[model samples]
Target chain A: MIEIKGLSKKYGSTQALSDVDLQLRPGEIVGLFGPNGAGKTTLIKSIFGYIPYSGSITLDGEPVTRKNITRLSFATCEHSFFPNIDAKAHAQFYKDHFESFDEKRFNVLMEFFSLPKDKAIKHLSTGQQNQFEVIMALCQGADYILMDEPFAGNDIFNREDFYKVLLGMLGPDECVLLSTHLIEEVSGLINRAVLIDKGRIIGDVQLSELEESGRDLMDYIKKSFSYRSDRVFEALDQLVPEEERHEEMA
Target chain B: MKKWLSVLELHAAMRFKRVLLVLGTMIVLQMLSFWILGDQSNTQTFFQVLGKIKYGWIFALGFLAMYWALSWPLGRNETYSYTLQRLSVTERGSVWMKFIFNALCFVPLVIVQAGLILLMAKIFEAGKPFAGNAHGILIDLEKDGMLHALVSFSNPAQVIYRIVYILIATACATHMEVLFARKQTPILSFIPPVILLLINNIWYDEFHVAFAAAIIISVICMITALVRCRGKKPLRDILEQQEV
Candidate 1:
């Protein structure tokens, strides 16, 4: 279990995250949903110890620090691997430092992605680089894996396929916190959705409850970000005459 | 110990090919310069001809090697969060590992220099330059004595301090980049070396003092770089926003 309490961050004048509290538990796939500039990346990055924050974060009851940070891993869309080395060499690097690294899992993931082990990772297309980055995070054998916009470069089919593969391969003791703007794509996949906008989290919903309410997940999220619910309807009404609006409504 | 060595070896491996390519190029260029531009007409010994071209090549070598060392471990654009988090040691360990690897790369240059000097000496001995004075070029350096022009490899003492001094220069440049470039620290990062160089110039006498000065200054700069690296903001910020 990982816990964050009163986490806040600022970048110069911009408050990237504000008084945020979140928890990541074992066996849960938590979706971090937010609009553009919603501080989705900031929240998770702070939890990962990428930046300093006012609050405390703990991994399995221990305070987060350099030695214990390896227990949680981060995979981002922007390329991170050394461009000179192949995927195999990257795996070796992880294996060298982290005792929990699972070679078998990495091999399986590579074969599934059809990633050639010997070619330098820099030569891989952007989408493939994203896939490899996610693979490394998952196979790092950490208790919690955090991904930021990892599926952006990948095709929809590949993204869908990876979601299923991830669901199947995740150990019961491991968990994931994935941050992305593709709310609809992950709407059905994630168990719980945490929504943030303008540096603060506005909604936390168990998908099961949202589903039981028969409210569309995307609609619920859009409402959280909505200032005037009728604004769109009013604009459309003006764009189309009353007779046409009535006809469309009908 | 083993993990630390693994880091060094991996870093060395990543750069080994490029270093070899550069080493080969420098050798060919040096040989070409010797054949074409060497001061054969005016000087007697290989050392005098070599001295004319030495400073420029040394500056070039130091500058090139130092730039690479500054970006050692990884490039500016690349994120090290993944690598740093996985490391068994502190982030400071990353810098130390890079230092070892970058220092090791200097070894080949020294060996090649020694070989070139020995080969030149052999050529100079075959009645090649003087046809008169086999004692070799004591030309402008006669004040330093003819013995100073003796082939250096047979006397390792002649080359070791020079190698150490070059390594120190490279190390200082590297630490400056780590502080000024990577960490985005204040201009104070440039101070330590300047102060140390001043002190070193005052104490300049033999290999003993130069070696001591180099080791002491390199250690201090490494510590400063590491302290700044750890205490400073994570590199992810610049990498996140910059064109890289």
Candidate 2:
């Protein structure tokens, strides 16, 4: 379980996240859907204490700090593995460093993904690297797992296999927060959806509610951004000649 | 204990090739110098050779320290990928543990070098059948007062001083490497260490004073790194507060 409140982040004059709030419960799979630069990565990084931000975040009612972070696991599309280390060695390093690392589970995931154990992480295809990252995170056996764009470079089959492996690996006490642009592929897998645009939480609803509303997740996301586009167009129209606006409309 | 050792092992693995290249280069250069000189005997020649070796060691250590300083920001950024966002207090122990681990790795290397020097002295004495006073080299070292001054500096005091100084340098280097490894402004992390190193060298004539000053400065740096690393707070809180 995690609780985040009034979280805001700024890089120089540009805002990356703005007053967003959310709560997650155990055993829940939440999909964070957003377009490029939608603050999805920022939110995920913030949860891992990788970036500094304003406000409060707590896991199971305990304040987050560098000490207890070992209890959580995070994965991102960005290359984090040591470039020179092969996949097997990287996994071994993780197992040695993290007490909760499940070596058996990691090996199984590697087998499932058909990742080359002897290949240096830097040499792996992007999809294989992502798979390796996913396997590493899952093996940590943390109560909370945060993934940022984990399926960025995968083919459709690899993506499907990843989802299947992820679903099968989830325990009753674990929760996973996956941020991605590919909402359609994971729509059915997620129980809750948090849609963000321009650094704000525009929609946070149950997946069931979204389906019941009969709007596709991708369409809902487009509509959320379209509202801003519409506002901008309206402002532009007000500056245009009346005859020109009418002609354009016709 | 295990986790800290694992961290050290990982650090070594990551920097293994670089360390090997540096040490290998130094050893080869030293061997070449010895080969060209034909043979080294007597206190005068021995001091010259030892002086060169000492300078070589210092240069290598300084290079390592600078490299570590330069890489701090990137290493820190890379480490964040594996770190949990929530700020907790456990990093204090982790930092100290890493400091110890790095010092332990370097200890054997230093001892082996010292042992080789002593063995070289014995071998030189064995080859000269005409030379009656073989122990003169050791006596001369004791008289020139560098070795005596070093050994009798404060009995066990010098060892402690050396250990602490080495630990601080290694710790700071390792921390910097982890902190600055992949950041847009990773060079920012090097500012403090470089500034301190420069300050220590400002009064070049005061070499002894500067060496002591450098040790103190490194200690302060280690403390600063521990504070910054331990106080890391999660980014999620920042995201939630954005006005978007």
Which portions of model 2 show Cα errors greater than 4 Å?
A65-71, A79-100, A116-126, A227-250, B37-77, B84-89, B126-133, B139-161, B164-168, B171-175, B178-206, B234-244
For candidate 1, what is the TM-score? Answer: 0.82
Q: What does the lDDT read for residue A161 in candidate 1?
A: 86
TM-score of chain B of 1: 0.65
Worst 10 residues of 1 chain B by lDDT: B142-151
Per-residue lDDT over B89-109 for candidate 2, one digit per residue giving the tens place of the 0 to 100 score: 255555665565556545544
DockQ score, prediction 1 = 0.28
For model 1, how does the per-residue alpha-carbon lDDT over A146-247 read when each residue is reduced to its tens digit?
998998879999999898899889998888999998888887678888988878889988899888999888888878877577888888877888798788
After superposing candidate 1, which stretches have Cα over 4 Å from the reference?
A: A227-250, B39-48, B51-59, B62-66, B69-76, B124-160, B163-167, B173-177, B180-220, B231-233, B236-244
C-alpha RMSD in Å of predicted model 1 compared with the true structure: 5.1
- Candidate 2 structure quality by residue, lDDT tens digits, A116-218: 8887666777788788777777887688888888878889998998888778878988899998877788987888889888889998878777779997777
Clashes of each: 1, 50
Q: TM-score for chain A of every candidate model?
A: 0.90, 0.86
